[model samples]
Target: MSIDWDRRHCSRKGHITYAPDEAGLRNRLHASTAVGTVWRCLRCGDFVLGEPHGSGPAELAPLVPRGRALRDLFILRFLAVERVLRGVLVVLAAWAVWKFSNSQDAVHQLFESDLTAFRPVADHFHYDLDHSPVIDSIQKVFDYKKSTLHAAAGLLLLYGLIEFVEGVGLWFAKRWAEYLAVVATAAFLPVEVYELTEKLSWFKIGTLALNILAVLYILIGKRLFGLRGGHAAFEAQCRGASLLEVEVAAGEAGGTQKEPLPVRQRSSTADPA
Candidate 1:
């Protein structure tokens, strides 16, 4: 089923109605009813009750997003949310790594004591602590040098910061943020693939897929890197969604738009009875 992105956004954010200085366009966008005046919402092109949100020249009208533009914004915000989550999670992981590095000795001692305590019980159940995969994983971490652990933590923190920047930029729909996200995501694809090669997991696969999709969607849909006529074309697509821009473009192209018919009046008496 098709989604009405325009109406969906308007429902959440409320209608954005404008009164243009140009009489022709203004009349087309507003109307008088028995109750009061209503203005046409730029976002949904629907007449709404009450005064307009803004009054200005046609050129000064707000570029309220609709249709595919709204959909694109929706997708970008979704990616932004994902980026924010990644930023938070990685930052926490980095902190955990740093803390673990600082208290390695204490942690190692505690693990040994606990393992010793569990040894008799494990032996009774025919479970060998020495060969346990989970225990081996922890022991291997203890094998890392303090400096190595600190370095790993630093890298994670830096990556988290980058993700945070991407998230904020994308949430605001900034062009530079789109470029940054594309580059960062593309650069990580190889690492993600390599990880999958080492150990196959659903979480890893899903993250990789989302990153890949984000990169492609931004690059192609946004016309980045001269693809699909680049930045100019992208801006043009955005402007096309604006009614004022459409009227201006039509004027420049020598095309005339037909104004809407006037509202009908109900006759008090029967017609020519």
Candidate 2:
């Protein structure tokens, strides 16, 4: 019995394959195609080799081949390193929280000192100093001057929490994590730029540059041509089992020398099973 090469199946890892019986011809696939296979399927009438994986919209370029997928995966894994970096940031944030929590007197002092500096800007921005319940409560906590310091510290704590979440997601190669990190990095760019404008320093410049690079890498480098999806598919394609394999094995048991049919080129995209 001939296995219909028309049907598709998950080969080994996750690659979609056609004509699984002709395992010997697997390496004969063209190297330049998407997943590095040349076999075609009569069922789909689409080229199965080199098709992009996943259901997302088609990107600008074709699916990256298996070899290129390996390289891209390596580069992207570096972004996961941010987890270690966030560990250090988390420590700093905890310290800040502790210091602010204990030093109510210092908060009061700083608020008092910065009173005049903050008032003009606060007023110009139409932030009600009197009727605003939030600011009113802060004044009670740490006088007018230290109120802003308390608020700043609170903001930093929130940022720290967000960073922690982002770090965890990225480390696990979650898609949402990549999207969140890109957004957070972009949101920080304006603030970093504003800081540099106030007083251009080497440290500030370097910090801003790093943030920009991080955003770029996440949005463009990681998503547009990232390998996590494609690499997983290519590995699947390299697997040697399929319905065709079963038929070929049975034929051999019967001492039949039936020649495996030529692998057909599938016209439709290969679903990375």
| Candidate that would win on TM-score | 1
Candidate 1 — worst ten consecutive residues by lDDT sum?
Answer: 264-273
Query: How many Å off is the CA of 70 in candidate 1?
Result: 0.3
lDDT of 1: 0.81
What is the TM-score of each predicted model, taking all chains together?
0.87, 0.44
Clash pairs (backbone) in predicted model 1:
none
Candidate closest to the true structure, highest lDDT? 1
Sequence-dependent TM-score of model 1? 0.87
lDDT for 136 in candidate 2 is 70
